[model samples]
Target: MGLLDNMKARIGPAKEKVSHLAQRHGGTIGHGLERAAKLVDEKTKGKYSDKIQAGTGKAKEAMDRLAHRSGRSPEKGEAPQAGETPRSASPPSSPEGPPPVS
Candidate 1:
C-alpha cells in the first residue's frame, strides 16, 4: 500500500474511537470548547474575535455532528429549525434588478 493508504488504514480505528467518545461525552466536550474559547478571547482582548468565533462555531458543529444532533439530513436541503432561518428563502435583494443588464 502507498504511504497515504497505510496512514489512513492505521488512523481509521482511531477516528472511530474518537467518534464514539465524542458521542458519549459530547456535552462535556461542548462545554469545554465554550470555556476555552471564552478564556482565549479574554486573554487576547477580543483581537481575534472573528477567528475565535469561527473556530468555536466549527467545534460546536463537529460536536453536533458527532452526537447526531445537528438536525441536518443528507437528503434534505433545509436545516431543522429552532429559531433559525429556513434555507429555501432567498436573502434580501437590492431594489435594482440584475444591475440594469450591465
Candidate 2:
C-alpha cells in the first residue's frame, strides 16, 4: 500500500473511536469549550473578547458536525415534536425575493 493509505488505515480506527465518544459526550464537550473560552477572555481582561467569542462559536460548530456524523446531533429547530415526522437536515427555504439583477 502507498504511504498515505497506510497512514490513513492506522488513523481511521482511532478517528472513528474519537468520533463515537464525541457523539456520546458532545454537550459536555461543548460546555467545556465555552468554559475555557470564558476563562481565557477573563484572563485577557476582555481584550480578546470578540476573537474568543468567534473561536468558541467555531469550536461548537465543529463539535456539532462531529456529533451529527455519528448520528447524535441534537440541534435545536432540527428536532420533531411528538406526532411529527423528523425533518431532513436541509436548510429551510428562504423567503427573500428572487436573485437581484446583475
Estimate the lDDT of model 2: 0.77
lDDT of 1 by residue, 1-102 (tens): 899999978877776677778888988998999899999999999999899989998878766665564332334575643434555668888897566765
TM-score of each: 0.57, 0.65
Please give, for residues 1-102, the per-residue lDDT of candidate 2 as tens digits: 999999978887776777788889988998899899999999999999999999898888776666556633345667653333554657788879998789
Stretches of model 1 off by over 4 angstroms after superposition: 67-102
List the candidate 2 regions with Cα displacement exceeding 4 Å: 71-102
RMSD to truth, every model: 8.1, 9.2
Q: Which candidate number has the best lDDT?
A: 2
